[model samples]
Target: MRPGELVPIRDDAAPRVVERIALVRAAGAVPLVGDPRWSASHWQQVQDAASRAEPDPQIAWAAVTSGSSGRPRIVLRTAASWSSSFPVIADLLEAGPDDAVALPAPAVSSLTQFSLAHAAEGGPRPLLPRGRALVAQDFAEATVLHGTPQALRALLDAEGSPRLRAALVGGSHLDPALRARAEAAGIRVVAYYGAAELSYVAADHGSGLALLPGVEADVRDGELWVRSAYVAARYLDGPLRRDGEWIASGDRATLRDGRVHLLGRMDDAILSASATIVPEEVEAQLRTLPGVRDAAVVGLPHRTLGALVAAVIEPDPDAAPSLDDLRGAAAAVLAPAHRPRRWFMGPLPRTASGKPARAQIVREIQTGEWVRLV
Candidate 1:
């Protein structure tokens, strides 16, 4: 580890993640999670960026993009940027000594890595589920689970966390049905909206997504621009760049009554029937429909309309919704352009962090891999 250098720390052991972070910071190198899933070329390109860029001793850790939209790149931020939000997180989660916070692969997720770091500073006891498959027995000792909506659903599918009391959810929309399932299991849920570039933007404790402490938000040109100490300083090799002290997230949102309502990512917007449709608005509507476990709305190539609104559904194992069922339900809520014309039901394509892989789904649909419904 040297000045402006990146040290790849690859480990699944929860306890050691903090030690690795500390060691890298002490040695004047940026701590970067060496996810095995990342290609050698991508890793090398990030390393090259670190080697070329001027080093900042304050920059504590680095995380790569989730690749939900495009190529992954390094996001640099200070250790204090995350630690500053620990109290807010602690207040939000209330992880007691008796509570064990369960999360998956730390080597791939900065969220998990940050959770482990938080644990190191006396948050909650971080626990790795017993085996590869997150079964009920794996979370037998756990009281709280930290993950995205997709990860939570996977845990629920694996016979559920019987003893779990709370879930800290993020990364995507939390469907009403999913929330109801957790509530039925006696597990309380708290969700927050954020990006790797902008740390903790707004959190939904109970009501809606209110801006987190030390964050100032503004909706500019339909995108949320955040000014916060928690924002990452730079991107190693990506299109997104910070403007001064503020970083603009690609999320299309509206800040009203001091709460943020996310529409969708600008990349996920569908241009259909001469209208721009935000996929999240459609996906959120679809998730409320019966028999849908989760959903991803994407824009597929269309001959006349330029792009047609399409949907890929992750159906519940017990029951799957038909094309007509979804369409009929969507008619009441979504505008014609926002309504998905092509429908496909199956397991959704997700990134390493469990966010919908919209670009991947579009490609799958284009290649005739995901069969469209009438």
Candidate 2:
């Protein structure tokens, strides 16, 4: 395939794949681009669009990775390089032919490859045709299931089933309450951690998150750095290669008991005078409070403290609780640094994938839109 080849692509996969194909084309590498959802004529349109664009001789192979929200950036990886991680996922999931799997739409994520491998265990496992119609009935016989945290919650809520032996949760943080429910229902829910840059770095078995074989990770100065076989070639916008190896992730983590516990992003940490405030720690404490359904804690720019903690929370509608009462509940178990000095009610802004939109909310606060009602 030469640059601007009109390959019929399908939207059935994550948007990242399409973006990757585009990046390759932009770099003078040819790609036949078409959305699977589109007809032949539409494919022609895509091809024409690519054909008309001026090509750059030196385009980086790195794909722009999209988080749950925020801007997407390039992360270079060859098809062969990304596929190497799949077999490990296959082994971890123990996917078999008899094992049916239910996947959310845009099923082309790195983790979803586990389901694909499971289906392929037989000659060809039937893919649950793309749609929002995936219900308990859809996967009554499915032994394996995979989805983003929010997607899984919706599936479990609308059709909580007891058939699965294993479930993979990723693309965002998993809520403790959601975990407890899935476990109670006889489903072994595993929290998966990885970025588009590296697929399936670690996953929880029935026991807990264990680093996949051959993947190494370490915490330095409270930030997580990963050296693995799955890393991409280079950033789409920047030069390929840094130092020698290893990408310094924005995530902050702690290495305890031979496992990495993610502690939010290092850039988002609030440096208030002498004390460093971790907003996620405060948010976690708030979520444990009675009547708090969902919560996000962020630092509001402050004149003296440098940054002060501000919490935006969703109260359980059934409880109809007050902020004072919620704070009182948090007081018993939370330290002062973990308490929100300011509180706002209603839904927290989340990414399309449903992680808290901390960056967006922080911007709103800085612009004086997120007013403190309590």
Candidate 3:
């Protein structure tokens, strides 16, 4: 098959998706699974990337990276890279042949595709909801749930949580308060850390994420490096930093008590005149403030400092927290330099996978598209 030739998948059915994946692998054709929500330009970019990709007979599939921090690209992976972890993940979720796995996400998302591939192993055909809004009836027979933290939170808020063996949550940082709520409702929330290139790096039940079995992880110069059978083969457009078997994760983390505590993305660090601040850390504290539903922190260009910390918050509908109130609350937990210098109140822009679109938000803020609250 030609490199630029595309096999677009729009069907969300589990069996159909599974069959198509198998067929593409057999034919050595690149499969592009994109939702209709993607613009025509996005498809064109995928085609362009495919044309530039070096042909690799070992590549079984291609998936678009979630462009939360920057532009999206197509990543190449062999079937074994993902299939090797099915048994481990299934065991973690306690899935059995008779159990029904429910994946409440779009078909294009990597998490949904992974769930579908796992379900194809022997379990009863999985239940795949069209969108994130899942009703109580959707999980009536489901034994396991797999989705992002936002989707799981929506499910809990809508249906008050259903009985499940386990809930595997990923794609973004899992807020401690949200996990507490889910746990209080009798649902086991397993938070995982992974990326498009590296699958199933680490997971945690209550403590920090511990490296999965058969996975090797090391922290070097404040960045995480992973080596495992589940690592992707290569990137179709950009370069993946791989030193032999180790793949640089581009994430900053710390090893504490044999568990991985992720600080944030190395690229998301904010440099001020006096110190460096990690946005994820500040955002976590911001989320705990009164009347704050969600928050995103980014560094804006400044005259004296190279960059200044700024924040965008999704305030609660009933009560919107003022800048002074938020600052007062954050002051207790955050250092003086870490507090947000500029504040905007509104819904944070997110990507298809429900991750905060940091690059796009920064651009909007720089261009005056986002109104400043302070």
Strongest candidate by TM-score:
3
lDDT of each: 0.73, 0.59, 0.74
Worst 10 residues of 3 by lDDT: 65-74
As a whole number from 0 to 100, the lDDT of residue 367 in candidate 3 is 88
Off by over 4 Å in 2: 3-64, 67-71, 108-110, 113-129, 132-138, 160-162, 206-208, 239-241, 269-374
TM-score for every candidate vs. truth?
0.67, 0.56, 0.68
How much does candidate 3 score in TM-score? 0.68
Better of 1 and 2 by TM-score: 1
Pick the winner on lDDT between candidates 1 and 2: 1
Tens-digit per-residue lDDT, 23-132, candidate 3: 76457665778654444555555556566665676766667764321134677777688889988787777776787767776666677777666665664346766443
Candidate 1's residue-wise lDDT over 1-374, tens digit each? 67557777755444475577767766778777764434455455556655676666777778865432123467877778888898888777877656788785444466776776677677788776544455566566778888877667777878556778888887656776788888887888888888777877888867899998889998889988899878876787544556777787877899899999988666666645324466666677678888988999887776435577788889999988778888876665554446777889899889999989988988888888987787
RMSD of each candidate relative to the true structure: 12.5, 13.5, 12.1
- Scored against the true structure, residue 261 in model 2 reaches a CA lDDT of 81
Clash count (model 3, backbone only) = 0
Per-candidate clashes come to: 0, 20, 0
lDDT of 2 by residue, 235-326 (tens): 44454334357767667887777677877667676643223456666677677778889889877766434467788888799985686797
Residue 371 accuracy (lDDT) in model 1: 78
Best lDDT among the predictions, by candidate number: 3
Candidate 1, which segments miss by more than 4 Å at Cα? 11-28, 50-54, 68-71, 96-98, 129-132, 237-243, 269-374
